[model samples]
Target: MPIRVKLDDMLHERRLTLSELSARVDITLANLSVLKTGKAKAIRFSTLEAICRELDCKPGDILDYSAED
Candidate 1:
């Protein structure tokens, strides 16, 4: 996928664990894990907003795009 989930990097930068973020965002650990691992197929806008709210970051901080060869 050209779009990459940079959730792990954002968590690291914020000194937060997946479990911590899950609790703060009121999301299941499994779902957050999927996103963190870049295995998720899609994300709800509400979910994105929750993550951004807890992480104090913009959407671009968690997602990136790159051209695939």
Candidate 2:
């Protein structure tokens, strides 16, 4: 995947647990775990918005893109 999920890093930086973020973002732990582990194929804009709102961050704080070698 060209896009990398930086969710774990952001969570760590913010000192938030997965459960806390899930609750605040109104998302399931399973779904958030998948996203956290970079296993999600896609994410809805609404969900992204909720996460950003809860985390007080931009999308760039949770996602990154890099070129393939």
Candidate 3:
């Protein structure tokens, strides 16, 4: 995928666990795990907003894009 998820890096930088983040965002661990592993097909704006709010980061901090060939 051209879009890469940097969730792990953010979690490490913020010293947060996935379980904690899941709770803060009110998202299921299963769904967050899929996103964390770069396996999610899509993410809703509301969910992203909640994550950003809890993590004190921007969408760019969590997601990055690169040209694929």
Candidate 4:
């Protein structure tokens, strides 16, 4: 996928575990893991907002787009 999720990098930079992020975002581990691994097909704005607010980051910090080769 050209669009990628940078959640792992953000979590690493913030020194946070997926469990911690899940708690803060009120999202389940399975779902968060899906997102973190870039396997999720879509993300709701409210969910993204909650994550960004807890992580103190913008949506760009977690999401990126690259042209497909």
Candidate 5:
């Protein structure tokens, strides 16, 4: 996957638990966990907005693009 998920890092930096983030973002823990673990195939912009707002971060903070070798 060229796109990497940085959710765990941001969460750790903010000292936030997955459950806390889920509640804050109004997303289910299971769904958020899938995203945090890089198992989610896609994310809606609305969901992204909620997450960014709650975490006070940009999409780049949670997602990154990398070239394949």
Candidate 6:
């Protein structure tokens, strides 16, 4: 995928664990782990909003495009 998820880095920078983020955003740990590992195929707008809200970050901070082969 050209789109890379930077969720792990964001979490580290914010000093938050996946479980903590899940609790704050009301998302399941499995789902958040999928996103953190870049294994998720899609993300709903509501999910994105919740993550951003809890992380105090923008969508771009969680996801970015990488044109590497």
Instruction: For each candidate, give its TM-score against the true structure.
Output: 0.97, 0.96, 0.97, 0.97, 0.95, 0.95
- Per-residue lDDT tens digits for candidate 3, residues 1-69, read 999999999999999999999999999999999999999999999989999999999999999999999
Writing each residue's lDDT as its tens digit, candidate 4 over 1-69 gives 999999999999999999999998899999999999999999999999999999999999999999999
lDDT of 1 by residue, 1-69 (tens): 999999999988999999999999999999999998889999999999999999999999999999999
Give per-residue CA lDDT, model 6, range 1-69, as digits (tens): 999999999999999999999999999999999999999999999999999998899999999998988
Evaluated against the true structure, the overall lDDT of model 1 is 0.95
RMSD in angstroms between candidate 1 and the native structure over all alpha carbons:
0.5
Compared with the true structure, what per-residue lDDT tens digits does model 2 show for residues 1-69?
A: 989999999999899999999989889999999999999999999999999998899999999999988
The Cα local distance difference test for each model comes to: 0.95, 0.95, 0.97, 0.96, 0.94, 0.95
Best-performing candidate as measured by lDDT: 3
Reference-based lDDT, residue 5, model 3: 96
**Which lDDT value does model 2 have at 18?**
95
Off by over 4 Å in 5: none
Per-model RMSD to reference:
0.5, 0.6, 0.6, 0.5, 0.7, 0.7
- TM-score attained by model 2: 0.96
Worst 10 residues of 1 by lDDT: 34-43
